[model samples]
Every structure is written in structure tokens, then in C-alpha cells.
Target: MAVVSACIVALSGCALPRSGPKDDEILAGSKAEGGPVNVVLVDNRVAVASYLDDNLSFPSSFTGAGLASTDTINPGDVISVTVWENVDPALLVGPGQKQAFIQEIQVDQAGNIFMPYAGVLKAAGNTPEQLRRLITRKLDPQTPDPQVEVRRVAGDGSSISVIGGVGAQGVYPLVPSTTRLSAMLATAGGVTIDPDVAQVAVRRGGTTGRIFLQDLYDDPRLDVALRANDKIIVEEDRRTFTALGATSTQARVPFPQGRMSVVEAVAEVGGLNGNTSDPTGIFVFRREVQSIANKVTGRNDLGENEPFVYVIDLTRPDGVFLAKEFQVRDKDTIYITEAPFVAWTKILTATSQTLSFTADVVRVGDLLTDN
Candidate 1:
């Protein structure tokens, strides 16, 4: 009997109440503390729905200045010049020379292109049409009514660059016809990672902006026109959160590039452990900037912008709707406390096993004595 009592005492001690405060108690403590980090009880329907509707949005379009549409002649560009003199061909060239003169020239580093009668002419910084007019003006003295046409055969100076997380990385030339962002990405063989979770970054001039790939697809206006020398990058999404406590799995889980709700986050972690999880104790721990915290809780005295604990009571049937509306942010901690009964169940099971073993020992001793 003494042995049984000892076992019972040990089991009872193991069954002592959990150490942490209850869900409601935690909220009350936060209210009393008046600290920067506030504990918000998400027990209502209106607040959850309003937050979800207000805070979820795709990032705005990049408004930074980009390359201009005008294509100027640059060094290393192949320029083809053709001159036509209908009447006095001999004045431009030798006697009995053909009426038309065609020359293929490359713009030199000094921004100049040489012609037979026009001498060395500045081609760089001038459009093809502008250069043709200049060439015709220069040849007016040597030939009678000379007509000149200037064409650029190969010039890669006005091209956009596609690199990083793409199937192919290279400089893609931009034509006036196909200058949209989607065209440039398709030319580079598209992104290597999952498009749903990838982010597209556009760098132009000294400014850079990013948008999720899904946003570009959802809104056609987001596929803005591309410019020369712009850089487009696609990379894997970095938004993630950690799951802990009585969740089915405890691990870091990445969310889709777009908005993710608490319901989606829970499902990603394999949902709560049905037997151990306390339906009333679902919590999300998050830290926000001072301004954000103040705006969120409507409290002015938030100390150094500490973390906030947002609790959702899953025991209520309306919790499912609230969970669907509660957005989960990056680096958040999703925790589900164990049920109160779980500890008592463990203690009782251990006590029962100990009693059964003790009874067997006594029975064996009795059999030995009878023998």
C-alpha cells in the first residue's frame, strides 16, 4: 500500500496545472501592462473581417523613370547608308558609275561614320532618320538631288537584361512593337521557380521596385512597358512563418507570394493535433513597427514596439470564418496550446500501469509461497 501511495503521489505531481496563463488571462494581463506589445483577443467577427479586407493588397506598380523610347545611334552599331543620284551620277562617283551607292559602315568609338563624299560624319546620338537628313545635306554640293537612306542593322545598346532565377540569362533586344514587361520575360524563357510564389524585380536608372508574379498575371496593367537597360529579376518568395506547440508539425513554412490567411497557414502545417491541441488557445505571435502597432491597436503608449500576441478561440464555430480572414505575415509564430485534459490523461495512464505491475508482483509472491 505504501508503494502504491508513492506511485500515486508521483503521478499526481506530474499532473499539476500547466504553467502558462490561460487565453483570457493573457489578454487581461496585456491590458493591465500597457506595454508597447499588446495582446489582442480576436474573438469578434467584425474586427477580423475588416483587417483582412483592408490590409491585403498587391504591391503598387513601379513608378521610377525608365529608358526612353527614342533609339539613338551608339558606338558599335552597324549602319547601312545608301545614296541615289538619279541624273548626275558622275558628279558623286566616277564617270559611268552606277546611279546608286550603298555602303555598310559601323559607328566608331568617336561617334562618327565615314562616307565617300560626306567625309567623316557624326552618327552617334542621332536617330537613323536624323542621320539620313544630315548625310543628304552634306552630299548636296557634290551630287544633284542626292537621296540617302540610313538603316541600323545590328545595335544591342538599347536592350533590357534578364537574369537570376530565370531559365536563361542574357540581354534581350527591345523593339518598339514588343516592349511590354511580359514580352521581355517570355523572351528570357520565363522564371525558373514557381511563378505563384516568385517575385519580379525591375531595376531601372537608380530605382528598383518589386511585384509578385501573380499580381502581374491578375492585372494586365501591371505588365508595364519595358525600357532599354532595364533589369528584370525573378526570385523565390522569402515570406515564411514558424509553427510550434500542438500543431501537427513544427517547422518553418513558406507562404505563397500573395496574401495568405490563418486558415491557409494552419493547413500548410498539417493542421492542429486533434487529441492534444486546445481549440481555445490558438495564438499568433508577431512584432510590428511602432507606427504599425499604434495604428493596429489604436493605442498610443506602445513601449518600444514590442511583439503582440493575437489569440483566436477555435472552440467557437465562428472561429473558422475568422481564421479564414486573419492574415498571417512573415516570420510569425503560430502556436496551439495543448488541451488541459491532456496532462491529466497522461498522469492517469501512468498510475494505472504502475498499479497493474504492482498487483502482478504480489500475485507472483503468493504463488511462490504456496509452492
Candidate 2:
């Protein structure tokens, strides 16, 4: 029994159950498969700044200024041309007819429209007024004074496609009033999801860019102008982080906002468990890029795929402030370890339970001997 008790005492550290790894255990397992562990102590301003630098943002490709005019004629637009000649014999209409009304004339793919007597004229890149003047010049030789009026109607080339997470998903035309992205979205009916979590992706030509729908409301500059053939998609934000160990709740929590800090993420999971949480062992695990890993760990030799663990101790005076500034990235694992005393209590409780079971067996043997 003495030998068995001695063995149990020596092996208790390895055999004890735990909610998650301790701080030292996590550090000891940093290196794996020949890659060095990049443990970053996020207790200072520098470390917090390094993590904040990795925030997701709208690139320049998405934020550039867009064209202000939506009235220009493009291919596949429907145009209407009406001609009125005051002379006795009209060049475009019959002798008795006072005016010629041509309607529903669709612009061809080459951006040219044809009139009965005016021939084919370039209509694209010209506003309705400009195109009207062009047509008047074309018929001026035949008639003394030709008055031409050009009207642009809705068609394929002047419209955009709005789909996903909206009240109505379909093709919408870009008129004078609905030329901006927000106006187009409003025409299609507002987003079906929460504006806070909604993401809007704009695909123009060969490039695509995504931004939070709420961003358009926050900064009017981000409300980009809509163009022909542009595809806009609205969807929910998919960024998330995992919470484990001595937290009050353990689960995968989605980002409540576009830019979230470590402290905010902790609060999303109901904060740390009061009974077993170790304030000094709060950690955020991530697969970090080489440049950011170098900045956080002060190591130039780190690889792009290295694993990083950022530690934050709430007991320090600056810890809470650091956590507030340190950004929580997508796919990060936020873990709070159990207190040291909790493990010792577990060991004591297990040993007491074992001793009680052993005494019960011995009493049973004594009863058999008496029988």
C-alpha cells in the first residue's frame, strides 16, 4: 500500500483531469514538427499594436471614387427618337403627318442606334441631350430645321444584378436616382439580415471587393456608385472565433462587429469562470502570417505558417487596456486556463475517494472472515 501510494503521488500531475492545458504546458508544447512556437505576450502596447495591424479592411480597389453620371447611353439601352419638321414636306414623316414618332428602338451591341432617315449614329458615351443633338445634325441637310428629342429607357446594359440576403433578388435598372450602391439596394428592398452583420460584395469587371453593409451607413464615402454590368451581393458576416477552457461558456462565437477586440470577444462568451479561471493564463491561439508573427515575437526567422499564442494576464494593471486594444482575428482560439489550486483540489479529492473505496473493500473482507 505504501508503494502504491508513493506511485500515485508521483504520477498525479500526469493523471489529473483538466479542462484545458495550463500556461506552462501550453508553452512547453509550442514547438511541433520542427516549427518553433511563436508565443506572444500581449501585455504591452507594442504587442497590441502588432495584432491590431492585422485587422480586415476594405482595399483601395473597393474604395476608389466612381463615376457620378448614370445618364450616359450604353449598349443594350432602349432609346426613343421623335422628330418634328415645321416645313410643309417633312423629311422623316409623310407629307400630311406633322411629326415622326419612333419608339422602342433598342441600341445594338456596338453602341449605335438607327433612325429611318438619320442612318446609324453612335449613341453610347452620350447623354440623351447629346444624342438628340447628334440626330438633329444628321437630318439637318434634308430638312430646313429638324427638331429631334432623344429619350433613354430601361434595358439590359443600364442595369445591375442584386442577389443574396436581400428582400428581393433580381436585376435592377440604374436610373438617375438609383445610381449609387445604397440607392440600388434600397430599390431591391433593404437587406434581409441584420445590417450590422451584413456584408456587401461588389463585382465590377474583373475585380471584386467586400465591405460591411453598416460601413456604408457609417461612412458615406464608402457608398460606391453603381455601374452597368456590376453585380452586388449582400450576405451575413462569417468571421468567428472559438472559446474554450475555464470560460463561462465554451463555443464558437461569431464576431458581433467588423472590428472586435480580445476583451469584447471574452465578454461575448459570458466572460471567465469565477471559480476555476486563472487570470494570468488567458491565451489566444492563431496561425499567424510571417510578418505579423515577426512583429509580435521579435523573431525574424519565423515561417509564414507558424502557430502563435498570444498571452494576456488580467492581473496586471495594463492587462485590461492591452486586451481592449488587441484585435481578435478570425479563427482564433480564446482559452482561459484553470487556477493552480483547482488542480491540487482535484488531486486531493481523487485521493480521498480512492482511500474511502479501499477501506470499504477491507471491511468486506473482515465480515467474510467473521462469517
Candidate 3:
């Protein structure tokens, strides 16, 4: 018996939850001191939808940052180059000398470009500017000093894909080393109100990481280095917000950010339905994993093991305040009860729920009340 117990402990690492509430609580809880939790937080996510999605080229100024991009040019890649020799305008100067003939440059199997005098030179792995300099160096020997310009007429470096919740989709500018994914989101015109920042996926080769676009506004942790031939996908979270109980105005909003909290969510909807608001009866329906089976499958529904619901009373000053700061994830239904009097409204919800795209409905409820 003793040996069997010891073996069980050792094997716990590989064990999967069986089923029920106990399993969900153990596997799907948040790591933060007060994290917004649920089966969805573990599965679905979209950080901030209200903010602008930056879609710009690698900033001309991001040259010094140690951004590492694993992007490389392979064969069959097409490119365009505009070459010049001293003051001679014939090689590149168009028929009217109005513009130039170089629209797109193509690379050959030999890995070279046939410029007027520079002949063929290596371009794979080198940036446009890097390629330009290589061409200039070759021409300088024959011409006093030469100027060379290179553009990706049709190639991997010039194309970028924007997905998820933005107004526009498809490829945009192929920014340089300094450009980040957030910059491109803005270029595509930012995310819609039902934005999916968390599930925004970026894949290079087999490597992938979830990007939190909201973090782009301040936190540097979520920053992802851009690369050519990389795909940035905005994935959607399938869920909804169900508002029920004492609040005057209640409805289901979009569900993609996981479970939202009582107070933060209430304020987001415009604060308790003023006319007849209850201070108690605030409840948020959340998903709590009960067993390993529920967690392993990434399920948000409560299992027989765990019933995920918290009756948070906003009547008490302390509880009321916690509601303002806590987040509400997707699949969370925030129920605000009516307060005894407008008297409680005197206190300001200075630290309230983060603004969202859906309509805000404040519910007044007693933290101790049962739904």
C-alpha cells in the first residue's frame, strides 16, 4: 500500500483530471493574485477591442532595437531594382525621364540581379537597403560615386497578412526589421469593437505565440518580431455575455475575452439601471473546472465536480470596490441587483470596469444574496 501511494504521487505529474468541479478548480484557475478565471480564459481570449490596431511599416526610427526576425528569402522570390550610374539617366531614366523602369525585381536561380554595370549580385538574406549598398559598392569603382535603389516589386518582404477583427484584410506593407505586428494592425485600420486581441496568432515555420494587442499600448512583454512569409491571424472566441436578474437593462454582449467580473462589468454597461437598482444580488456566472477531464478538453461549462458561480454583493463598501477593478471574461453573465437607495450611488466607482463595446448595465446586489 505504501509503495502504491508513493507511485501515485510520482505519477501525478502525468495524470489527467477525471471529471467534476474539483478538477476544474485545480486546472483552470488564474495565476494572478485575483485573476479572471474560467474554462474559456484557459481556452478563448481577445485582450482589448476598443483600441486602434497599429499597421505601419517598421518605423524608420526602430533601426537600433535588437529585433530578431528569422525571415529569409528563398528561390522564386521576385524583386525590383532601380540602378543609377553617376549622373547617367539612360539606364534607369524612363522614356520621358519622368520616372523609372524598375517596378519589380526578380531573383534568378543563380541568386543575382543583372544591373547595368554591377552585373549580378547576391540578394537572398539581405534587406533592400543592404542590397542597394552592395550595388553601390560595385559601381563606385567605375563611376565617381553611384546611387542604387531597390524595391520589392513582387516578393515575400513586401507582403503582410492582417486577419481577425480589423476593417480590412489581406497583405499590407512589408515593413523592415523595426516593424512589429501591432503596427500592422493599425495599418489595417485597427480592430472592431468585437476585437480578438488574445487569440491573434502569428506563425513562422512551426513556431507560434498568442499576441495580446492591448499590451502593445504599454506592456512590452507581448511584443512579437515581424518576419517575411509569416502569417498574422486574428482568431475569434466563440462565447457571449448573458445579463440577468435585478438590473433594469440586461442583454447578452459578445463573448471572446473570457469571463468578466461583477463590478468592472456593471460599470461598463452604464452603471446600475438608475431608476430601480438593487445594491445586493450581484452574481456573475463563471465556469469552474471540476476535474481533469473537463480541463484537458478546455471546457468552460461547470462539471458535476465544480459549479462556477460567485454571488458578489456590491452593497458592502469593500466588495463593491473589488467589483470595479476585477475583470469579466467571456461566457460571464454579470447580474447586478437593486440597491436599497440612490444613497449608495454617492460613492464613485473611480476604479471601475474597463470600457467595452457592448452596452453597460450596472446591477445592484448584496454580496451575500443567492441568485
lDDT of each: 0.75, 0.83, 0.52
Question: Given candidate 1, what's the lDDT at residue 146?
Answer: 83
Screening candidate 2 with a backbone cut-off below 3 angstroms (N, C-alpha, C), the clashing residue pairs are none
How well does candidate 1 score on lDDT at residue 286? 79
lDDT of 1 by residue, 209-277 (tens): 688888888777677777667799888888899988788899898886477878888888899888888
**lDDT per residue (tens digit) for residues 1-371 in model 2:** 79457646864856687888888888776653333666667756555556644433455756676665777889999988889898877777787887999998898999988887779999888999999998888889988888888888898869999999998999988887888888989899889998878899888888887888877888887787777888999988898999999999999998888888889999999998999999998999888888877776666987886788888989999889888988888899999999998887787677777777878999999999999
Off by over 4 Å in 1: 1-9, 12-37, 43-71, 74-77, 85-120, 303-305, 352-371
For model 1 the local lDDT of residue 358 reads 80
Q: What would the per-residue lDDT of candidate 3 be over residues 169-273, giving only the tens digit for each residue?
A: 877655453367677777777776454324466666676555445445555545555665567776565456777645545777654343444554665566677
Instruction: Pick the winner on TM-score between candidates 1 and 3.
Output: 1
| lDDT for model 1 | 0.75
Off by over 4 Å in 3: 1-65, 68-73, 80-105, 108-123, 126-154, 164-168, 189-201, 220-223, 234-239, 255-260, 269-278, 290-305, 325-327, 336-371
Off by over 4 Å in 2: 1-14, 30-35, 52-66, 87-96, 140-144
| TM-score list, all predictions | 0.80, 0.87, 0.48
